[model samples]
Target: MILLQANNVMRRFGADVLFHDVNLQIQEHGRTALVGRNGAGKTTLLKMIAGITSPDEGTIAKSKDLTIGYLAQDQGLDSQNTIWAELDLVFAPLHKMEKQIHQLEDQLASLDPSTRKFQLTTEKYSQLQADFKKRGGYEYESRMRGILKGFGFEEDDYQTAINSLSGGQKTKLALAKILLQSPDLLILDEPTNHLDMNVLAWLEDYLKSYQGALLVVSHDRYFLDRVVSDIYDLDNHTLRHYTGNYTQFMEHKQEWLTAEWKHYEQQQKKISKLEDFVNRNIVRASTTKRAQARRKQLEKMERLERPETDDKSIHFRFYSEKDSGNEVLDVEKAVVGYNDQKLAGPLSFTVRKPQRIGIIGPNGIGKSTLLKSILDRIPLVSGTIKLGANLQIGYYDQEQQQLHPEKSVLNEVWDDHPNIAEKDIRSLLGSFLFVGDDVYKLVHDLSGGEKARLELTKLSFKPINFLILDEPTNHLDIDSREVLENAINEFNGTVLFISHDRYFINQVATDVLDMNALGIKHYEGNYDNYLEAVNKEKATNANQDESQTTTTKPKKSSAQQSYQQSKETQRARRKLQRRVDKLEEEMTVLEEKQEAIKEQMSQPEIATDIGKLSDLQKKLDKFTTQSEDVELEWTSAAEELEKFDQENS
Candidate 1:
């Protein structure tokens, strides 16, 4: 059953069209995700769907009885009510029913059992009891507790005033209330904003079992991978649906774009050949007739628009102008906090050259404090922080408080490096996606994402041997996060960073140090590998087994049989390589057809045919699925070939 539908929805701001001709449907119990780069109008479309705003044209039809709970990007509960009080309000209807039940009980006591009034009273009382049980009246407090606990709140904190809570705490309370309300359609914009990994995992499980449809907008790829089943991508002033989570959406989108680019390139080639022929032979007597005929055919042909690839992200490498010593940093028995307080005590760690160490912990656990201590912006209560010789530090503050709000984006970087030309500074800004008037925007006016990019722009140009980053991926979209990961991976220096982004840690961190108010626990691998190890240990303990091997099994083949195995590997490699070759050929043909359909869609005569347009969209979606599958198979085959060769050697 369809719960909500938007037909031909369009949203425009004066001359700028945000999105148009968008059509979507949310079915019962559907799990949909809205994703795009920042400022691509995802939140705007979400508002339209949630009825906070109306579309310029088209209709949004919702189920007559549908109840919705929408959580905006900056959700907060601002009231004098305590945490428990705020949450209890979600059960207001149940409270009213409870009051009615109480009154009925009193009336029943006064009425005679033999009267018709007594009989009717008993029937009503029984009906109310069943309704109360069905609506979870009995478990209301327990349910509230469960939700609060899942959001990293203790029972003791439940009665605390919401006004006294932090901004992030208020946001969590708001979300908890929405969850308890349990509306038919739950819409969240960036719901994963203030969630830590542990709370994030719990919320994922909580959302999975929810008896309602979900539409979410979040940048947490790992969380989305665990929750959403469908993706609604807002790009190029339109919404496109893909049948997968964030990772799968990325794969499908890349494949679709590849096919589209291929089509455009093929069309351009044909046009180039025809144009060359017309220019070369149009004036000649011998080939003039044929040239004129070619020109006419070219004019009749519909031109395919070039794929937009104007997305600008920072592209830079990190290298130390001077190499630091082998021991980049050393801290022993450190107590990190402000004044006389201790956030984490007896914390000892050493950072070596070229080691990318990721610091992870729950919110307000002094991860940032630790970094500040090392930078000497704050003092350590106990242990000494030693830096190796010839060291230069680059720090990225997550709050972006280090930036000068009064300065323009151009002047922010230019003031530091006065020797660099103004044009050069603009060029650098362009790499970070700050182009034209964007560079003139004041730092205070920049979005969180823009400020992050600007900070990165400054950090990259610095000749630093060690970097200390605090929640560096805080406001970055997935693409920018990946770009930062790439830069960090390639940097030939030591790095100690704090991040809640598990995907970013998995890609860049060589080691992870789990911090808390107590102390730290180190893991010697990526986030996924660390979790695997932890879970495996837990499973062993739960099974009451202490003898399970944590090490990987060795290869069975011996040195004596190496020659025979090498020959076998060669044959396998050849087979896999042949498969890759075949997939490439199929990809080319699919791409050409993709472009042909796009050209047809762009034709002015066919554009007005709604049925034809819908059919083309469906066809395009099919092509995307097929192209992704082929690409995946090809990648696997290529990897298999490489692995076989490496193993045989």
Candidate 2:
């Protein structure tokens, strides 16, 4: 069943049409994600669907009793209410039903048992009780607790005043309320804005299992890929539907666009060829009939115009005049926290030149604090932070409060970097997708994403050797995020940034700094490698815990003992096999390099001269790096093999 349908939806801002002739049908249990660039009217379309705004030239038809829960990007709760009270309001109707049932029960007790009124009252009370049970009223409180907890809210936080909560916390609470409501349709804007990985994973699972329809406006590609089954791309004053996750949508959308451009090009070529043929032969005496035919073809040929693509993709390249020293930042015995509650270390780590580190933790777990401590915005309780000589730091804060709201976008860029030419400034702004009148728009009027882009545009103008970005991808759309990610990847300087975006981490992080209950642990790998290490540690811990628990238990039977022995033997064999595999890989690399050297030696002129000998020596030096890497691998593999053999013996 179609839950909501919009026909010929047209929205305009003054003389400019935001979207026109838009038709959309949302069926029951549909999960759709709306995607577009910043200022592409995604939020406006959502507002229209939620009835907070009206379309100038169309109607939205919603099913009767089609309860909708809409969470805007900027959601607010009544400041007077506590978080618990705010969520409890979602179940107000259920509470009312329970009260009415209690009243009926009292009336039944006061009535005569033989009376029809008494019998009817009893029947109604029984029905009410059953309805309450069916609605899970008995388990509602527990369910709410679980939901709130999954959203990174502690039990104590439930009673916290909503007014005291930060903007991000308020957004989370609002989302929790919506989840508790469990309406027929859920509309969320930028839902993953403040979510951590754990909370995000929980949400993805929850949304997957959600019974109702979902329409989300989010820039988190990973989140959309996980939760949304379909994508609605709002582009060029229209809506286009793609039947897949974000990744698949991107692939198919590009393929379709490519095919469309090709078709347009082919038609243009045909028209141009016909016009040329007609022009050349029209006045020729020898081919008047052919000329007439060519002219007819030219006249009949339909012109194909290409659809306009956004010319405002920001081309970001960081300007670093010179490289910093080997060590970019070093922290020794750093103790960082607030209000006497310490989060993580007594930690020490060094970020070398060309190092890209990702700082990850839960919502309030001091990821931002750590960044601030390094930046010297917050005083470390103890320990010293050292910066490399001549290090230039470029920081991108998530809030973007650094930008003066009164200034125009162009002024914001030019005010700080006056050395940049007007033409270059415009080009730089255009690269960040702020072009023409867009650059002229006041900073105060820009959306969060737009402001973020503008700040990035300004940052791109400066020369810096080190970057400290806090949630850099916070307000960016998917495309903008990609552009930033590409820029960061191309950067040669060191970067230490905090981000919850897994895709961005994978793309940019060369090292992982995980802040947890224990101090920050440095892993010499990206997010995937960190996960693997974490999993391995977890498995090892679990095995130790299981072994200790088993040892404390009563002695097992012979049959159980035999099973345990077999399991241990199999584990040892698998470990040995893994080591053998690594050694084999190392041997293969060594053989390949040796073969390459032999081939190089087989060259006739290069074999006998001093110049050739020098060239061969350079090749040998190049081969040494590869050989060293393989040797390291082989050593580790050999150690693992020996350890496994000793354990078995």
Distance from true position, residue 344, model 2, in Å? 4.0
Measured against the true structure, the TM-scores of the candidates, in listed sequence, are 0.82, 0.78
Off by over 4 Å in 1: 271-302, 540-543, 547-649
lDDT of 2: 0.82
How good is model 2 by TM-score? 0.78
lDDT of 1 by residue, 14-128 (tens): 9999888888889899999988888888899999999999999999999999999999986989999989898899899899999999999999999999999999999999999
* Model 2 CA lDDT for position 407: 97
- Residue 360 displacement in candidate 1 (angstroms): 0.9
Give, for candidate 1, the lowest lDDT window spanning 10 residues. Answer: 552-561
> Which portions of model 2 show Cα errors greater than 4 Å?
107-117, 280-303, 338-343, 401-422, 434-447, 544-649
Itemize residue pairs with steric clashes in candidate 2.
Answer: 314-431, 314-432
